[model samples]
Target: MNQTIALIGNPNCGKTTLFNSLTGTYQKVGNWTGVTTEKKIGQYRKDKKIEIIDLPGIYSLSATSLDQKSALEFLTKTPPSVIINLLDGTNLERNLSLTIELCALNIPMIIAVNFSDKLEERGVKIDLNGISKIFGVQAVCISAIKTKNLDELIDLAKTTTQKPFKISLTAEKGENSAVKRFSFIERNLDKIIIKKGTTAQNKTQIADNLLMHKTLGLPIFFVIMTLVYFISIKLGGVFGGVIKNLFDDAGERLSIYLSEKEVYPFIQSLVCDAIIGALGGILSFLPQILILFAFMACIEESGYASRIAFLFDRFFRAFGLGGKSLLPMIVSSGCTATGIMSTRIIEGEKERKMTIFLSPFIPCGAKTAVFSFFATSIFGGNALIASSMYFLGVLCVGIFGRILKNLKVFKNNKDEFLLEIPDLHLPNLNDVYMVIKEKIKEFITRAGLIVFCVSVFLWLLKSVGLSGYVADRVEDSFLYVLGEVLKYAFYPLGFCNWQTAIAVISGSFAKEAVVESLCLLTNDVGALFSSSYSAYAFMAFILLSPPCVASLATAKTELVSNKWFFGMLAFQTLTAYTVAFIINMIGNIFVWCGGLLLSLIIVIIIAISLIVAVKILSKSKCCACTNACGERKCKNKEKHSTI
Candidate 1:
C-alpha cells in the first residue's frame, strides 16, 4: 500500500516550486472540512508508494492561524510518513526556526536547503553536514527553482520510510539566540554547501532594495501593475475578437439551418438567442482569462511575489489590513470568486473578513467584458478610467476599513502581519506550465459543471414566459418578474427596467453572468436601453456590486457566519445603487441634469466622507496597523486568531 509524505515549509521557501516539480499536475485540489483553505494532494511519479500532501505555506506548525493550524493538525493528528522540510538557504536562520519547531514533533524528516544560489551570491555559505548534525536529520542541498539535483532528492525521499525522527525541543538559550543563529548560520554556511552565485542573484538583491524603497517603490510597483493591466487588456481584445467571429459565424449558420428546416420562428429564436448567442458569446472570453492566468502563474512561480507583498506592507499596514491582502486583491482583479478563496491565507478574522468584503472592489475578469464594451464606446478607450476603476476599488476598500475601525464588531484587534521574502528566481517553464494547466482545468470545470447548468437554467428563464410558459419577449420570462419589482426602486438610477435589473440580480451567482444575461437582453432592449450612456453607467453599477454567489458562499464558509455575508451583500448593493445613480446623474448633466437631481446629494455625501478620512484618520490609522510583509519589523508575526 502507498504511504503519504508531505513537504512542509515556510512561505517563500520554494515549497510550491518543489512540490510542482515533484508531483507535476498529479494533484488534487479540494476543500478541508469546515474551513476555506483549499487542500492539495498529489503522488510522486517516481514512487507509487509515496503520496505528497502540499499544505499551505506556513511558518510554524503551532501557529494558531488557518494555514499554521492546518499544518499542526496534519502533523500531530495524522503525521505523515516522512516530512520533506524545505529551508531557505539565504534565510536559513529564520527558516531553521520552523525546522526546529518541526523537529519537536519527532516526525521522520529531511531538510532540503533551497535558494543556495542566492546564498552564495550574497557571500553566505552553509555547512550541510553541520546543519544535518545540529538538526538530527538528513539535509540535502537542492534548488527547486533551478531544478538542481531535484530527481536525486526525490530518490532520497523514496528511500525514507514512515518513521518519526526524535529530537529534544530546546531554544538554544541566549538574549541574542535568534541573532546568534543568524550569525552561526552565516559564518559556518560554507562548510556544508558551496555556491557559485550568478547574475540572477545580483539582480534579485538589486530589485529587492529598490522595491522596498520608502517612496519610489510604490510608484514603480503601480507602473508594473499598469503593465499587467495593459497586457490583460491586449490579450482580452485579441481573444475576444476570435470569440466574436466564431459566435457570429455559429449563430448565422444555425439560423440558416433552422430556417431551411422550416422550424417555427419562436423555437428558432429561443434556441439561437437564449442558448447559443448569449452564453456562447460570454464564454468566448475564457481563452483570454486562461491566457492571463498563464502569465501570472509564471510571475508567482519565480517568487517575486514576496517582494511585492513586502513593499506594499509598508503602506497596507497603516490601513488596518494585512499586506497579505495584496495577493487576494490581485486575484480579485481576475475574479472575485478566486479572490475570496485566496483569503484562506490571511490569518486574522478581521483581516480575512475585511479582505473578502473589499475584494469585490477590484474589477474581475468578468467585469473586464463590461469595461471594454463601455469605456471604448464612451471615452475612446480611456485607459485612465479603466485604471481608475481598479484604484477606486482599492480606495473603497481602505475607506470601508477606516469607517469600520471604531465599530463594536471590530474593536481593539491587533493584527500580526509577518511573512517570508524568498530569494527571487526566474520561474521555470515546467512549473509555469503546471500552474497554467491546472488553472485552465479549474476554469473549464467551473464553466462546464457549475456555470453550465446555471447558464442553461438562465436560458430557460429567458425563454419561458414569466406568467407560466407562455411565449413572448424576455420581459415575459421568469427573471422579468423578479427584476421588475426591484426595477421600481432603481428608477432614480435610470435603469428601472426588468432586462437591465435582471442582469445585476443574476450577477451574484457569478459576475460573468451579468454580461452573459446582458447579451441575452440586447436584441429585445437594444435601442431603448443600450443606446444611451446609462447603458454604460448601469453596467458599472452591477460590475461594482456584491461578489458572486461562489464568493458569498466562500465568505460564509470562511467567516462561519451568514450574517456578515449578507451584511456585506447589503452594503455592496447599496453602494452599487448610489454609485450608479451619481454617475448617471453626472453624465446626464453633460447631457441633461436639469433639477431632477437627488444625484447631487449622493455625491456630496460621498465627497464629505472622503474628506473626513483624509483630514482625520488616514495617516495615523495606517501607521498603527501591523504589517505582515517580509521585513524586519514584521519578522516575529506568528498568527492573529480570528473570532
Candidate 2:
C-alpha cells in the first residue's frame, strides 16, 4: 500500500530538508522561521505511488499563527495515513512539547529525531527506544542533512503502531494545559535524554555578539552589501564581456553567411537583430545573476539574514512597519511574486496590503540586472552607481512607509514581532548549489517564455506601421507613433525620445525587456541619450514603476479588490514619474557643476523634501488621533500613539 505521510515539525527543525530528501523536490528550504508559509506535495522518489505532504512548520497545532492554522486545517480536513513528526534532537525538551500536542490528534505518528549528528557531537544521547516505549510510537534518530537512517525512519513510520487517543482535541486554552504538556515532556526526557555537561555559550553565541552588536550592525550590513555588488557587478562583468564577444562573433559570421545566400531582409533582421541582439544582451548577464543568488544563498545559510531582520526590526517599527515586512522585502529582492506570497505571514490585512504596495520598490533580480547593465554601459562599469540604485530604492521605501503609516486605514494596527534565531553552521555547499541552480533555471524559463514573446512582439511593432506595414523604416511604424504619444507624458523627466519612451513602455510587460527592446532599437545607446541625466532618469522610472504582469496578478489575488489593485497601480506610476522628474531636474541644473556638487545638491533636495513631508504627515496624524480619542486627551494620546 502506498502511504500518504505528512511531515510536521516546529520551525527550523529541518522538516523541509527531510521532505526534500525523501521526495527529491526543490521547495525553498531555509534556516529561518516562516520560510515555507504554505503546504506542498511531492511524490516519494523511490516509489511514485507514495505521496508526501510537506506542511508548514508549526510549534503547536493551536490556531495562533497562520502557519499553525494552516497545518491544523490540513490535518483536520484530510488526515494522512501516517505522520512523520520531525524533532530537533539538540532541543529535545522543547520539541517534545509539540509532540505532546500532536498526540491528541488520534492519528498514527512516528517521531524522527533530526539534527542527531549535532546532538551526538555535543555528547548528548537520546534514548530513542526508551522514548518509543513511553510514547507508544516508533522513534528513530536520523540526520536529514547527512541522509543517515532516513530510509529506516521512513520504514518505521510506515509500520508504527498508533498511540492511544487520550487528550481532547477541544482542549481548554489556559496555563494549566501548557503546564500539563511541559510536565509530560519532562517525564519523558528524564527517562531518555542524557547530557554530558551543562550547556554553555558556544561559537554561535560569540559570533552573534559581534554580528548583532547594536552599534556595528548597520555598518556591517552596508559593508556586506558593498562586497556583494562588487563581486556580482565587477567580477561578473569581466566574465560577461567574454560571453558577449563570443555571441557577437557568431552573429557576425551568421549575418555574413546569410547575406551571401541572399536571405530575405526580414529573415536576416529577425535572426540577427531580434533574436541574437536582444536575447544575447540579457543572457550575457547570466554569470552576474548566478553570483548574486549565490551570495543570497550564503547569507541565508549562515543564519545572518535572520539577524539582519532582527537588527532592523526596531527601526522599521518606527516607520510603522512590523518585523514581518522584512522577509517579504528581502524575498522580493529575488522575485516579487514570491515576496508578495510571503506576506501571508502578516495576519493584519492592512499591514499585508501595505507590504504588498511597498515590496515593488525593492528591485528584484531582473531589475538589478538592468541597473547593472546600464551602470556599466553608461558609467563605464561603475559598481557604485549600480549599488546606489538599491540604496535609493530602500530610501524610497522608508519615505513612502512613513506616509502610508499615518493614513487612517493603517492606524492602530501594530502586529507583534517574534522569531527564533537558528544556530550558526557551515552552509552545505550542495544546498547553496541547489539554490543557485533553481534561480538559474527560473531565469532561463522566464527569458524563453515571457521575454521571448515580448521580444517578438516588439520586433513586429517596430517593423510594421501606418504605410501598409513598412519593414525597414521603423520611424514611420506604429511603435514610433505610440512612443511619440507617450513621450510627452515623460517629457518633464527628459525621457522625450521615442526609442527611450518605447523601452519604458515595453518595460511594463517585463522589466528585463527594457534592455531587450533598447537593444533591438538602437546599436548605439549614446545616440538615444541626449545627456547622461536622461539615462539616470530612465533607469529611475523603470526601477520605481509597478511590477510586471505576473506580479500584479499575484497582488490582485492577495488584495481581492479591483479598486485597491487599480489604485496601487496608479500610485506606483505617479510615484515613479514624480521621482524621475525630480532627479532629471536636479541633474540638468547641476550638469555644469562637478560630480561632487551634483551629489550635494541632490542630497539636500531629498533631505528637505523628506523633512517637510514627515512634518505634514505628523501633524495630520496628531489631529486624527485627537479626533479619534478626544480633545481633552490629545496631549496624552500623542505621547502613547501607535500610528
Candidate 3:
C-alpha cells in the first residue's frame, strides 16, 4: 500500500528542503517564499513506498492568493493522510502562527522544526515535549539541511493517528481569528524556547544596512547584475564553444558515415541537417543555461531577492505595480513558464494579469542564447550590444506598463504589498548544484522533445514543395514560399529576407529554435541581413515578442480566458513590430545623414505615430477582446470590459 504525506509550512521555512531530503526529489528550493508556486508530487526512492505531495507555502489558509487557494483546497477538500508541518526554528515566533492554525485542522501532524543547525549556532534551543503538549501533536526538532532526525520524524509520521481535538489554548477561536492564536503561540514560545542572553549583531541586518542603503542600493544591484551577466555570457560562452566543437565534429562524422553507407538521401539530409544541426545547436548552449541558473540560484538562496523586492517596492508602485511583479520578471529571465506560475503569489488579480502580460518582454534564457549568438556573430562579441537588448526590454516594460496603467482598463493597481525578508546566509553549494542539475535536465528533455519535433517539421516544410515532393533546392520549397508571404510584413523592420522571416516565425514556438533554424539555413547569419542595423532589428523583434508556446499555455491558464490570452499575444506582437520598425528606421536615418538633423526628423515622425497609437488605445474604451470587425466574443458582453 502507498501512503501519502503532505509537507506544509510558511514560505522560506525549508519545506521544500525537507521534502527534497525525504524523497530525493529535485524540486526548486529558494530562500524566498513563492518559489514553489504549485503542488508537486514525488515518490520516495526508499523502500517505504510512500508518496509525498509538497504543497505551496502559505502563512495561513485564508485563501487570498492563488497558492493559498491551493493549500486550502488540499487541506479541506483532499486532506492528506498525514502532514509534516515544517518550521524555521530561527523564526519560531513568527513560524508558529501557522503551526497553531494547523492544530485546528484535526489532522494527524508531526511538527518538524527545520533549520535546527542555524538555531544551534544562535544558542537557541526548542523543547520538543513542551511544543507537543501545547499543540497536542508530536513535535520533533530536526534540520533538513543537516539531515538530522529526518528518518525519526518520518517514522513518527508513519504511525501518527488522527483524532478530534479542541483548539482551546487560544481564547479568540472563531472564523478568521488570528490574534489570540498568535498570542497562544507566543506564550508557548516563552515556555519552550531558551535563548542565550545578549545575542550578537546579526550579519544579515548588518549587510542589509549597507546593501539596502538609499543611495547605494540601486547601484549595488546594477553592479551585481552586470557581474552575473558577464560571467554567464562571457565565461559560459567560452565553455559553450568547446561543447559546440564536440557536437559539430560528431555531426560531421555522422553525416560522412551516412553518405558512405549510401543511406537514403532524404533520410541522410533529415538526420544530418534537421536533427543534428538544429538539436545540436540548442544543446550546445546548455552550459550557458546551467551557469546562468547557478548564479541566479546563488542570488535567490542568499535571501537577497527579498531585499531587492523591498528596494524596488517604491519604484514598482510608481508604475502601477507592486514589488511582487518584480519577482516574476526576474524569474522570466530564466524561463517564462515558471515566471507566469510565480505570479500566483501576487494577491491582486489585476496586478497578476498585468504581470503575466509583461513578463514575456524580459527575455528568457533561450532568448539569452539567441542574444549571445547575435552578439558574437553579428556584432563581433560586443557585450554592450547584448546588454543593450536587455536594457531595451526594461525600457519597454516601463513604457508599456505606464501606458496600460493610464488606460483605466485594469483595476486593482493600488493593492497592498507585503513581503517577508529572510535571514541571509551563504548559499549551500549542494542546493545550488542540485538546482543547476535540475535546470539542465529540464532543458535537455525539452530540447529533445519539442526542439526535435519542431526541427523535423521545419525540415519537411523546407524539403518539400508543390511541384515536387522533395525540392532540388531549399529556396524552391514550400517553406520558402510561405516565408516569402511573411517577409513582406517584416519589410518595415528591414528583415525582408525569407530565411530570416522563417527563423523569426519559428522562434514563436521556441526561442532557442531561432538560432538553430538560422544554423540549419546558413552558416553565416550576418550574410542574410543587408546591414548590421537590420540584424539588430531582427534581434529586437525576437526579444520584444510573445514568448514560446509553453509560456503561452501557462499564461492561458493563469489568465483563465482565451480572449485575454489572445489579446495579450496580439498586443505584445504589435509592440515588438513597432519597436523594431522604429529602431530600423532610426538606424537607417543615422547611417544616411551621420548627424542629428535627419535622425531628429525621423524621430519626430515616430514619436507622433507612437503618441497617436497610445491616445487611440486609451480613448477607444472598447473591449480588448473584440475581433477586427468590432464585434465582441459574445453579443451580451459589455464594452470596455476588463481584459
Candidate 4:
C-alpha cells in the first residue's frame, strides 16, 4: 500500500535535510527558515510507492505568513498517513512545543530527532524511550546531515500505527493557548531530556561578536560579498575559458563538417551560428554560475545568511523593508521567480508585495550571464565591473524602496521581523554539491530549451526579409526594420544600433537571451557599444528593467491584480531607462567634455533634481484638515483632533 509521510518542524530544524537524505533528491536545503516556501514531494528510495512530503517550517498551526498557511492548509486538508515530527536535538525544549501541538492532531507520528551528532557535543541527551512512551509514538535519534540511523527512522515511520494521545494544553485563568502549550512542553522536559554536562562558550556567539558588530557588521558583509563575487567571477572564469574553448572548437568543427558536406548555407548558418553559438555562449557560463551558487549555498548552510538579515534589519527598515526582505533579495541573485516566491514568508501583505515588485532589480543568474558576457567583451574580463552591477542593483533597491515606501500603496506598516539564527557550523559539502548541481542543471536546461528555441527564432527573423530569405543582407531583413524603429528609443542610452536593440528586446523574454541574441547577431559584441560608459549603461538597463517574462508572471501571481502587475512593469521599465539615461549622460559629459569638474557638477545637479522631484511626488495634502495644505503640520489640529 502506498503511504505518504509529511515532515514538519520548526524553522531551521533540519527537516529538509532529512527529506533529502530519505528521497535522494536535492531540494534547496538551507540553514535558515523559509527555505522550503511550499510543500515538496519526493518518493522514498526504498519504496517508490511511498511518498515523502516536505512542508514549510512552522512554529504552530496558527499560521500568519503565507508559507505557514500553506503548511497548515496541507496538514488539515490532506492529512498524511504518518507525520514525522523532526526535532532539532540541540534545542529540544523549544522544538517540543511544536511536537506537543502536533500530538493534538492525533495522527500517527514518528519523532525523528535530527542533529543527533551535535547533541553529544552540546552536552544534551534525549531519552528516546521515554519520549516514545510519553508521546505514544515511535522516537528515533537520527542525524539528517550525517544520514545516521535514517533506515531505522524510516522503518519506525512505516510500521507505526495511529494511537490516541491526549495533550493536556489546559490554560489557567488569563493564560493564552501559546503559554499553555509551552507550559506542557516545560512539564515534560524533565522526563524526556537530560543535560549531561555544563555548556561551553558558544562558538556562534563568538563569531557573531565579530561578524555582527554594530559598526563592523555592514562592512564585513560587504567585504564577504565582494570576495564571493571575486571568487565566482574572476576565479571561475579560468574554468569558464576551458568550456568556452570547447564550445568554440565544436562550433568550428560543425561548420567545417557542414561545409564539406555541401549543406545549404542557410542550414549551416542556422546550425553553426545560431544554435551552437548562442546556446554555447550561454552554457559556457555554467562554471561561473555554479561557483556563484556554491558560495551562496555555503553562506546559507553556514548559518551566516540569517545573521546578515539581523545585521541589515535596522538599515533595511529605513528603506521600508525589514530584515526578512534581505533573504528574498539574496535568493534573487540566483533566480528572481524563486526569490519572489520566497517573499511569502513575510507576514505583511504590503511588504511582501513591495518585495516582489522590487526583487527583479537584483540580478539573477541569467542577468549575471549577461553582465559577465559584457564585462568580458567590453571591459576586458574585469570581474569588478560585473560585480559592481550587483552593488548597483542593491543601490537601486534602496533608492526605489524609499521612494515606493512614501507612496500610500506601499507605505510601511512596521511589520515585525522575527528570524531564527541557527547555530554556525562548517558548511556540509554534500548540501553545497546539491545546490551547485541543481543550479547548473537549471542553467543548462534553460540554455537547451528556451535559449535554443529563441536563438533559432531570432536567426529566422534575421535571415528572412520582405523579399524573402535574404540571409546575406541582414540589414534588409524584417528584424532590421523592427530594430530600426526600436533603436531610436534606446538612442539616448548610447547603444542605438539595430543589433543591440534586438538584444535588449529579446532580453525581456529571458535575460540570458540578451547574451544569446548578441552572440548570434554579431561576431564582435564589443563593437556594438561606442564606449565603456555606454556598455555599462546598457548593463544598468538590463539590471533594472522588468525581469524576464517568467518573473513577471510570478509577480503577477503574487501581486494578485492586473493593475499592480502592469504598474510594476511600467515602474521597472521607467526606472531602468532613467538610470541608464543618467549613467550615459554623466559618462558622455566626462568623455566628450574631458572635464571631471563639469561631470561632477552635472552629477550634483542631477542628484538635486532627483531629490526635488522625489519631494514633489511624495508630497501629499493632509487628510486631517484643509488648513494643512502646503504646511508641514496641520494648523487647525484642534478642529480635527482625532486626525
Ranking by lDDT: 4, 3, 2, 1
Task: Put the candidates in TM-score order, highest first.
Answer: 2, 4, 3, 1
Local distance difference test, candidate 3: 0.82
lDDT of 3 by residue, 462-545 (tens): 888876657448778998899889889999999898888889888989999888788777778899888898899999999989
Q: Which candidate should be chosen as best, given lDDT against the real structure?
A: 4
**Candidate 4: 10-residue stretch with minimal lDDT:** 625-634
Give the whole-model CA lDDT for all candidates, comma-separated: 0.67, 0.81, 0.82, 0.85
Taking the tens digit of each residue's C-alpha lDDT, what string does model 1 give over 1-643? 6777788876756676677667765331211111124447887767766788877667666556666776788888987778889887866656876776777787778888887666755666667777777766777878876778788777766676533344443345663444544565456555555553443546767877787677788888788777777886787778877887887789889999999999987778767765676546566667667666665665555565656677776566555677787777877777677778777667678877777877888888767766665555555777665666666577777766666655677656577666655545666666556656776777666666555556667667766773656555656777667777888877877777876677776676766666666666665444435335576567667666877677777777766777887888887887777777867777677566554554676688789978975755343322222543333333344541110
Q: What lDDT, from 0 to 1, does candidate 4 have?
A: 0.85
Tell me the number of clashing residue pairs for each predicted model: 12, 0, 0, 0
lDDT of 1: 0.67
RMSD of each: 6.4, 4.3, 7.5, 4.8
Summarize candidate 2's per-residue lDDT along 518-622 as a digit string, tens digits. 878877876677788788888889888999877998999988899889978987898888889988887887876768888897698889988976764454333
Off by over 4 Å in 2: 164-174, 196-198, 345-349, 466-469, 588-643
Which regions of candidate 3 deviate over 4 angstroms? 62-66, 162-165, 169-176, 196-198, 253-264, 467-472, 591-594, 598-643
Estimate the TM-score for candidate 4.
Answer: 0.90
Query: What TM-score, computed on C-alpha atoms, does each candidate reach?
Result: 0.82, 0.90, 0.88, 0.90
